[model samples]
Target: MLDISVSAKLKDLVPDFRAGVICYHHIVIADLPQIIAERLPLFYENIRLSLEDHPVSAVEGVKEWRGIFKKAGTDPSRYRPSQEALLRRIGKEGRLHTIHSAVDLNNFFSVQYSIPLGIYDLGHLEEPIRITVGTQEDQYEGLNGRIMNMENKMISADRSGAFGSPIVDSRRTCVTEQTTDALQIVYTRPSTPAEESRRMIKKIAGMFTQIHGGENEWKIIE
Candidate 1:
């Protein structure tokens, strides 16, 4: 079972912060679609087509995320939430580097729902994935190899220190082609609700079931 905990420190800062999590095991990530790096044009083309039908309206959670970022002593305009960042790119560039199916699905959901989502390889994580406030020493290397400091912000950490946040994630728990056991998290803000979060999970789950033709062996994340 995955042990998920939230600290009062984080609750005090963003009391409405909630996450809806789902776990999927025994995925055949290697057998999924290829062309990860070469699919940027395709993704952009799709986004462009959809932008006409579904104009890139500001996601409802964006305002709350901006406030949360400000409360955390971070610049909301500079360090945008993951979903906001993706939406900006879609509205402007509409391009994303190709990642495998799992990561790609997360991106799809991010842009679709305007929520910050991350999939972490459970195989790489230690138990007690605690959600807590960041300290001065809680810096971790992002997947892009840029070192980010997490002072006065909410962070998700395991035994190895912080790895994920509402803004950016670390490379240590990144999902890859070899990832079979994974935990997907939809980070919610005050502007988000449980119903909306569940819809996001359901959409991703349905896509996985359709594409991979496999079942998710989910366990309780108590």
Candidate 2:
């Protein structure tokens, strides 16, 4: 198992911050299985329907995350949380194309629960992962090879440096078709109950293993 913790500096800034970590190992990754491929459209449709009545920013979960981001020193409007971004995409395009089995599974729950979820390839990370506030020097190549400035942002760092954040994840740790072990981080809102986070993690693990046939374990950190 990987060692993961939240730093005191970040805790002091956002006292209610909580995270759920799911470590899944010995898995096979490939194209989505038939059932998952078939289920995604309907699931995405439900997400679109859920947001039809309100703007994505007006969602209770998004609002809570905006507050958390503001407390953590990042402007929420400038760098929207991943869940909010996904919801907005679904609301606009009505669907998201599949990346791979692992990413698709994480995105499913991220949209369902309105939480930012990131799945990292464990093989690419160093040990002793810590969730802390990024320093001025913290920066990484984000999705699509774009550089993400991590200054003053909440981030998950390994020995290599900041690889993931609620707003965007670094490409270094992004899962690929060759990946077999992964760490999925659930960026739970401060207002979310512990039990709720636990249940969400459990459900994620269940769904992941169901599709990929792996063993997964999870824990919460605050």
Candidate 3:
């Protein structure tokens, strides 16, 4: 386990904000598990149909994140939160291309719960992680390979600096097939009940271990 804390700055902005962190050790990473390969398309189509009659902005989950981003001084329409992005993709494309098992699983749960989920290789992180507002001076190479301007956005930072956010994650901590240890962060909506977050995190841990063969422990940080 690691020391993870929500900064006072963030707490003051979104009083009920909470996050669920799942830590995995010695987990095997696969390109694609048979079960996920078969199940992902179904999940994507289900979400697409569920949102077919409704715009992504009309979704309760997406609305919650839009509010959060506004409070953080971010323009939700410009840099949409990860959940809204995923939901919009499903609405437009009806399916997502497979990455690896870990990423695919994260995306599945993220869409199912309408929350932004981030997974990182533990080898790249430092202890005493803090979730706080980003600064103009803070920038890092995102998973997309471009320098991310994290200014005024909510972000997760270790001693090495910002590595993940509800919007995007830095490439420095991205998980690969060779990774053995990882951390999955659930950026829950402020109004989401604690019990619901717990159930989701537990489900994520159970599913990951069941598919990838590993042990995991999880906690909620507020």
User: Across residues 98-162, which tens digit of lDDT does each residue of candidate 1 receive?
Assistant: 56777777887776666788788999999888878789999898876899898876678999899
Q: Over the stretch 51-157, how does candidate 2's per-residue lDDT look in tens digits?
A: 89988999988999999999889999999999899999999989987888888888888888888989999999998999999999999999858899899899999
Candidate 2 residues lying further than 4 Å off, grouped into runs, are none
lDDT of each: 0.73, 0.89, 0.89
| Model 1 pairs whose backbones collide | 36-98
Extract clashing residue pairs from model 2: none
Which numbered prediction scores highest in lDDT against the true structure? 2
Ranking by lDDT: 2, 3, 1
How close is every model to the real structure, measured as TM-score? 0.82, 0.96, 0.96
lDDT of 2 at 177: 86
RMSD list, candidates in order: 3.7, 1.2, 1.1
- Backbone N/Cα/C clashes per model: 1, 0, 0
Residue 182 error for model 1, in Å?
0.6
Collision pairs in model 3? none
